[model samples]
Every structure is written in structure tokens, then in C-alpha cells.
Target: MVYTKNKNKNLIGDKVKYARLKNKPKITQNDLLARLAVRGITLEKTAISKIESKTRPVTDKELVAIADALGVSILWLLGRE
Candidate 1:
């Protein structure tokens, strides 16, 4: 299997990449973070960078925001099987 940097090593990079691509028509990482912050969730640019690069884990709550921001299901971001 191809190994990625995500701590889970279970398709996180691909998932994040997919999510990013899905939002391509309008949203962006920085915009997503701004929206999340507006919703009372505080996430830093580096944190998102790490998560996208598969160097960090996406928290449960953050997963929700990510899904929403990307217009996908939380299950998708978590790579649910």
C-alpha cells in the first residue's frame, strides 16, 4: 500500500486533497479557516497545512467543519470504511 504522511496512514492526504479539489470553484484553505473561526472554531494556517499534508490528525470537531467547508460529508474526510 502507498504510505502517506498522515498519522493514521489511512488515506488522509488523498481525502484532504479531494476535499480541497471539491471546493475549488469558490472556497480555499484560508477561507475555510476564516469560516470556521466565525463559527467559533479556532484553527491556524499551519494546523490546516499539517493536516492537509497528512502530518497531523483532524480532530473530531474539526472534521465536521472541514466537511462543511468542503461541502462533503464528515465521513468522507475521515476516510470512513
Candidate 2:
């Protein structure tokens, strides 16, 4: 299913961008892409950029993988913790 931006959503992409940037050692988009690749999520750098820029929607599986790769809790990524 195609996903579009929803104003009522919890701004997950923004939260993800913040978590990624705030990570220790400062993770880069390419580094994140590589990490996700290791987790079997093959996303292009542009896709990562778009995700970080809040222009793309992150899937549930991607969210889990990203949180794992970033060493963050899913709750944190979801802004619930």
C-alpha cells in the first residue's frame, strides 16, 4: 500500500531523523543505509534522505530495523518513551 504524509500522524519521520542524528558518533545517511542493508532492508541513499527529510513514509518493518540499527527502542522512535 502507498503511504502519504498525514498531519495527524505522530511525526515519526521527524523523530527518526532526530534519533539518527543524535546517535553517538553521529550516524550519516550512508552509514544508516549500510546498517539497514545489513539488516536486509535495501533502501537507497535518496530514500534514506527522503525518510529523514520527512518526505517519505517509513514502514513498520523499516521502523523496527532502523531502531535496532540505531540502538534505540521502538518506543523512543515512536515518541512514546
Candidate 3:
């Protein structure tokens, strides 16, 4: 099996952290987890922290869920905005 590593640690980690902190009420990591859960995406708190710290790689599904949860576009998250 060939395993391909990501060129970037994560494309959206910084944006995720920014969106979470920039919300009107400032969404917590736990709150973002709950929102993702509501959308059928399960993730642990540490995972959220890792994602924000750019120590984790995010899947496409997670990206969509995260964008929805943070009320941001995937494009923006990917820094295309």
C-alpha cells in the first residue's frame, strides 16, 4: 500500500481557529464539536485542539462539517477567499 503524506500539515487549521474565535459569541471548541455532531460528524476535543494547532490533517467531510459549524465557506477555510 502506498501512503501519501500531505504537503501541508493542514489547509484550514488557522482559519478554523480564527472563525471559532471571531464568532459573535465566540464559539468554544466543545461548541464546535457539538455543532459537528449535530451534522453527524464526531470529533474529540483534543482533535479540535490538534486541528487548530495544525498538528492534524482534516478530511474533506470534516472540512465541510467544520465550515458549516463555523458559518464559513470551505473556500475561506482553504484561504481561497
Candidate 4:
């Protein structure tokens, strides 16, 4: 199944956008960094930004943080639900 933005409805992208929209931060990228930092993920703001835009890739652990910050299940991030 295709679960990517443009190509399809990417669960990861959706979850990230949902989480950022929930907080309404100053900048989307900044918000991603804040979320990751709170979870002790320690990634650059650009990295998260790239992930959101689908310009870069995320590791399994990073995906977990993305899921946690978004308050979504990991299975959801994996597009299981």
C-alpha cells in the first residue's frame, strides 16, 4: 500500500501535522524540534522539517518519537490503522 504524501496519505506526515496543529507553535519546524527534544530524540530542526516534507528519511526510533509526540499509536505511524 502507498502511504506517502502526494503519492498517497502518509501516516507519518499526517501524524506530524496533526501534532503540530494541536500546539500551534511559532514555526512548524521549530515545533517539530521542540517535540523531539521533549522526547529526548535530539534531532535537528531541519531533519524534522525534511521528514515532514518527505525530503529526508527517519529511522525507526525517530518514527517512535514522532508517534509519541503526536499522541498516536506506533502502528498508526506505520500505517497499520
TM of each candidate vs. truth: 0.70, 0.79, 0.88, 0.66
- By lDDT, the best candidate is 3
Which candidate's TM-score is highest?
A: 3
List pairs with backbone clashes in candidate 1.
none
Clashes of each: 0, 0, 0, 0
Across residues 1-81, which tens digit of lDDT does each residue of candidate 4 receive?
Answer: 765546432337655666667664433667667877998898865776667666666778888887787667888766687
Candidate 2's displacement at residue 44, Å, is 1.4
lDDT of candidate 1 at residue 14, scale 0 to 100: 69
Runs of candidate 1 exceeding 4 Å displacement? 1-11, 24-26
lDDT of 1 by residue, 1-81 (tens): 776553442335567666676664856678778878876779877876677777777667777776776778776766674
Model 1 scores a C-alpha lDDT of 0.69
Off by over 4 Å in 4: 1-11, 22-27
Candidate 3 per-residue lDDT over residues 1-81, each given as its tens digit? 676885556978889999999888999999999999999999877999999888889999999999998888999999998
Q: What is the clash count of model 2? A: 0
Q: Write one digit per residue (lDDT tens) for candidate 2, span 1-21.
A: 687856433346777678778
- lDDT: worst 10-residue window of model 1: 4-13
Evaluation by lDDT, superior candidate among 1 and 2: 2
